[model samples]
Target: MSGRFAELHLDQVQRAFGDTVALKGMDLTIKGGEFVALLGPSGCGKSTALNCLAGLLPLTGGRITLDGKRIDDLPPEKRGFGMVFQNYALFPHMSVRRNIGFGLSMRRTGKAELNRRVDEAVRLVQLEEHQHKFPAQLSGGQQQRVAIARAIVLEPPLVLMDEPLSNLDAALRLEMRTEIRRLHQSLGLTTVYVTHDQEEALALADRLVVLRLGEVQQVGSPEEVYAHPVNRYVAGFMGYRNMIPVTVGSQEGEHATVHTEAGVKLVGVKREELGSEAVAAVRPEDFAVVTEIGANTIEAVVEIVEYHGREQAVEARLRDGTQLHVRTNSRLAPGDTITLKVPAERVLVFA
Candidate 1:
């Protein structure tokens, strides 16, 4: 297959509902056979972007191109894009086989071709046992599988999924995530998935597009976005919990000394441009309980200990009232005075 068939491009895409702007000149280019996820909080216009790509919504400004052809003016049905919604939206009266064949039928495909495609899709989802069952008779996860089968039955060039697994329970969600990833790998389809769940995006996306208030915040691979966030918002969103205000005491060599409100001096490499005041971000896992003397060790009183299967999270407070969260395997009793070490490499300095 030609790579152009899977190519999708957006340039300066903008959408407005009357005076309220939903998307503000967004630009993105998704490569063929790549799984790109639009990840952000609610009302971030990720869905709007998807709608525009599917030709379900009109753009207020900018252009959308697919396979080197302008498609912003095309109708949804003419776009040849498969969409799986949060709600399965399956026909209660139609059997799973019939539902999967619905799209092919609409395209006036031959009965043999329709049946062949339906069978293929049903088997792909491993729903052959339920092929004769109606949507009402299937579990939430099964219903979602049918929805996916229906979307892929026609073999559209691009697939757009909007939180397709959100309705499932936790365990089922994980199962479906693995299934979807496997399916994408098998089909090599260019996919644009939208979800507010960070874990889902982190687990499934080859590239993540982070948005906030309809604007693109960052676009990178999951590891890049998680390990090196551009700002405090992105840092906190990626599970960097320990955020403390710090004043740059001095910059020497490759490291800078930051003074916290508790009068504790921390040595960390400055990742962001230095300012008089800044916020230091560090993940809980980056902190360790110090039994030996360390350069960035801080005296803390353990307030609470949370046991999380593999590790323990210690909630502590410094002498000058600075709250600290430390993660360590060493079990520390509550109210015990201990020292925690913040490693310089794991620290993120952001303004």
Candidate 2:
């Protein structure tokens, strides 16, 4: 699918169900061979956007173009895109081989071509040993592999995956994540994936489109979006567990010094236009237990501690009842006092 599906553009895309809108004016351009993930919480319209792109859902407004040709008006089969659903929507009675070749059979492809594609897809997914087994005989991961093989065997220019790994266990999900990335790279397929899992999105996508309440919040490369989120909502999704309300004491070019309600002063990199009121966003991993702290320090009492193998996840509370989560190597118990320090560069300030 190299140059066949070069570019896809979603221009002012909108989807609504009567009075309720699921997606609104979502604009995105995906180049060939790029992996883009639509990320947001439930009811955020990521799935709605994917359905719109796949022609499973009709557009209430705007248009979708593939290689400069409009396709929003086309039906699902007419658009010729492959979709792997979350439930691994395979026929229970069909064997792995039949499941993978279902699309070709429906298209009335030649027997010789169909067999060749099915065999290649089985090998591609490493499911050759189980080709004769039914879906009930296969594991969830294997069933998912069959679903993926079925989609790719058609050699669709674009692939749409709606949380394909959500049904698997953690270990299986991790393994399948690598497999999907390998398939995308080897086949050079343009992929649009939808997931609410930030870690999965960060691991699989070349770029991320973060949505909230049917609207796009931010779009950028994984590193850019992970390191620098545009707002508190995006920051929270990107692992910023602490959003401390503060009053800006001073503002420099791109940095600000703000005082928390507990009288803790923090210096953070500012990315938005701010007034006196602002929020300091910090990830749990960015906070460190320090003995000496002259700046960017918060003193709190530990409330709960969770052992996470490599490090301890501690929940602490400030004098004003604000809760802060900290990830540190030091062992601590409830009611213990600790000083947490955050580097200015690791902090993000938003209005």
Candidate 3:
């Protein structure tokens, strides 16, 4: 290992393409042994930021430092950082063992040392049985394992993964997510992962840096970010499928009563500085079917219902013709009228 990675800092890091900027000034400090995810949708600069950190793309301004020393100017190979690309990127003809040891071989590592490290890497990824198989011979999951093994075999203190699980199927993605977490803990690697999937970021990251249009939207622990998004855009990204326009009627401490554009009164926790107009963001799963008319309740007609095993995913239209997504266990079909109530704490109002 390259000694223990103490800390990494991106100070005012920016990337520009001629007149168009792909990443804005981003400042972040990542502690050793921490898993930080760069999360956002397509064209959100998550990948641009990761590439900048990896020395794949030169920064337009600012600098990156590791343990208080500048490393952003170093070439990727000289930085001694391991990288796992989105695609497996394994050599088609090379055997798994050879692929895992390619970096060591390129550095002219001693034969015995190379064998030992490759063997350990193979075991770490639990691919001992297929060590002799070429990339074409392995399954997608197995190929991904080989890719991971290849990177870790170098014993780089910091690992950068660019949507490493994006190519896998749903089941395989979940499986590899667990595997990646295990490897991070067992090896004590400082990981910077880039992904557009919010759930994956929440599941794997100790901290999340949400980006939008090249600018950082928020940075917080998964629990904090998921429970309390800072803005309407972030709320939408974090699975709040319903965004209702409202006019604030009254404010009481941290709660606000607002009249919806459709003239329905609803209460929600105030999350930001509000003007007369604000948005009420609610996660579909937060809506509950209520039997009585109460605070924060909405009367809507079910437009669509889809089975999601434990709950039914519903698309409903409010009296004012606003569509809302709700997740409920109630047995309901299209055209059925239902009253969905969201707890005040569950509804977030943002200006």
Tens-digit per-residue lDDT, 217-268, candidate 1: 8999999999878888788888888887889888776577898887788887
Better of 1 and 3 by lDDT: 3
* TM-score, one value per model: 0.94, 0.98, 0.98
Estimate, for each residue in 273-334, the C-alpha lDDT of model 2 and write its tens digit. Answer: 99999999999999999997668888999999999999999999988889999999999999
Off by over 4 Å in 2: 1-3
Q: How far is 254's C-alpha from truth in model 2 (Å)?
A: 0.5
The global C-alpha lDDT for each of the candidates, from Candidate 1 onward, is 0.87, 0.93, 0.92
Clash counts for the predictions, in order: 0, 0, 0
Compared with the true structure, what per-residue lDDT tens digits does model 3 show for residues 29-130? 999989999999999999999999888999999999998999989988888888899987898889999999999998899999999999999999999899
- The candidate maximizing lDDT is 2
Runs of candidate 3 with Cα error greater than 4 angstroms are none
Worst 10 residues of 3 by lDDT: 1-10
